[model samples]
Target: MTAVVNVFLKEGVLDPQGKAAHHALDSLGFAGVSDVRIGKQIIINLETEDRATAEAEVKEMCETLLANTVIEDYTIEIN
Candidate 1:
């Protein structure tokens, strides 16, 4: 099974990296980019074939190690 996790900052959180990227884009003349939010993607290969089990395990991984839940949110996809 393959699990993919996308982790990103919460809406109200200030993202310094995102801000920097936005500024850079503006300087480079990439106009009309109103905003940018940075995030991370993690891909994991699991031995289990069950999609339910993979999702559950990946969710746990996100909660325990992959994300700081207080400031970030995550979505999980299993295949």
Candidate 2:
């Protein structure tokens, strides 16, 4: 099984890199662009055949290390 984790800053938080990218886009004459937010993707392949255990482990991994819970949010997808 494969687990995919997507980590992103929560709403109301400031993302400097995203801001810079947005600014650059505006400067490049992309007027339709409004906002840009940055996030990260992590892919993990598990050896376990049990879907329940794999999901539990992946959630634990996200909570423990993959994401900053205070300022960041995450979503999980299992395949």
Candidate 3:
């Protein structure tokens, strides 16, 4: 099974890195680039054959180590 985890800052949280990237784009003369947000993505491939089991394990991984719930949110997809 293949698992994809997407982690991103919660709404209303300031993302300085994203802002910097946006500024850089503007400086490069990319017009109409109004905003940018940065986030983290993790991909994992496992040997599990069960979809439900893989989802559960990936959720646990996100809650335990992949994301900071206080400032970020995460979602998982298994394929």
For candidate 3, what is the TM-score? 0.96
* Full-model lDDT, candidate 3: 0.94
- Give the better candidate number (2 or 3) by lDDT: 2
**Candidate 3: segments with Cα more than 4 A from true spot:** none
- Candidates sorted by TM-score, best first: 1, 3, 2
lDDT of 3 by residue, 1-79 (tens): 9999999999999999999999999999997987899999999998999999999999999999999999999989998
All candidates: TM-score? 0.96, 0.94, 0.96
Query: What stretches of model 2 exceed 4 Å from their correct place?
Result: none
Q: Model 1 TM-score? A: 0.96
lDDT of all predictions, in order shown? Answer: 0.93, 0.96, 0.94
Best candidate, lDDT-wise?
2
**Model 2 over residues 1-79: C-alpha lDDT tens digits?**
9999999999999999899999999999999997999999999999998999999999999999999999999999999
Residue 33 of model 1, lDDT score: 100
